[model samples]
Target: MSRYAILLGAFAVAVMVAGGPSFSQEPGQKGPLVVIVNISNPINQLSAEELEKIYLGKRGFWEWGKPIKMVDLVEEDMNENKSARAIFSAMYMDKSLPALKSYWIRAIFSGKGQPPLVFGRREDVVNYVSQNMEAIGYVRMGELGADNVKSIKILMDNKP
Candidate 1:
């Protein structure tokens, strides 16, 4: 009886120490959406400005091909925040939620780029990312796995 109790305690301790699964996440918790591209894509590394330019149509063509289709989540997307923040911060701008509307408006009116094809939920974004070869989109980071989609590293503010 004492041995069983000790084993149970040890298991509990392991759970507590390991923090669950391959990535650190609480049970039932999810992460913000992430912007992912294909692994085979010619573009390996990009500055936020470069990413912004690509999304905004300021820059066209992936290194290996002509213009690639950029996917945007719809207005109601739940995973939009993280993706936006990652993109905007790369552009050296703030990504407060309120500012996003204005950003889209500017992009639309100026004809610099089109707003992303918005989706209702993270699952939709994930589905889209997994299926489309030319598609690049975002989903909650924690939600990503070794699925069909390949993730590109977004340049954090000043980090290399």
Candidate 2:
């Protein structure tokens, strides 16, 4: 088995011993969302401003010249109270769901760029990021387990 599988198994055991996993957090809390990329990706960190620009389609390529491929989780519903999508949107995109949708609509209408590929499941997002060297995506902290993907720190205020 791969090292990641072993680590993931250990984590599962620890969670079970600690009374199972708890996904809940207080309202307005941040940090539960993690950004991930293919293990081959050389980038280990990104600033909040850079991430926002990438998601907004203002940035197109990595510093090393690879075209960035972004993946996104589908909003659960109109009321995405505290989902990963909600947290990522509020923190990185700085827009509500409706506003982000409108931004994408305009972007596409003007042939500027298309939104990231959307996946309904966190596992799918992780899998895609792992498979594509240029891909980046976000997931709940607990959802990352694949050996082929690695989470990079998001620098806020120029600090990681």
What TM-score would each prediction reach against the true structure? Answer: 0.58, 0.77
For model 2, the run of ten residues with the poorest summed lDDT? 20-29
Positional deviation of residue 40's Cα in model 1 after best superposition, in angstroms: 3.7
lDDT of 2 by residue, 44-138 (tens): 99999899989999999999998999998874442454667666887786677778889999999999999999997788998999899999999
lDDT of 1: 0.59
Global lDDT of each candidate: 0.59, 0.83
Cα displacement (angstroms), candidate 1, residue 84, comes to: 7.0
The C-alpha stretches of model 2 lying farther than 4 A from their native spots are 1-31, 75-79, 158-160
Instruction: Judging by TM-score against the true structure, name the best candidate.
Output: 2
Best by lDDT: 2
Give lDDT: candidate 2, residue 118.
94
lDDT of 1 at 60: 64
- Taking every candidate in turn, the Cα RMSD to the unseen true structure, in Å, is 10.4, 11.7
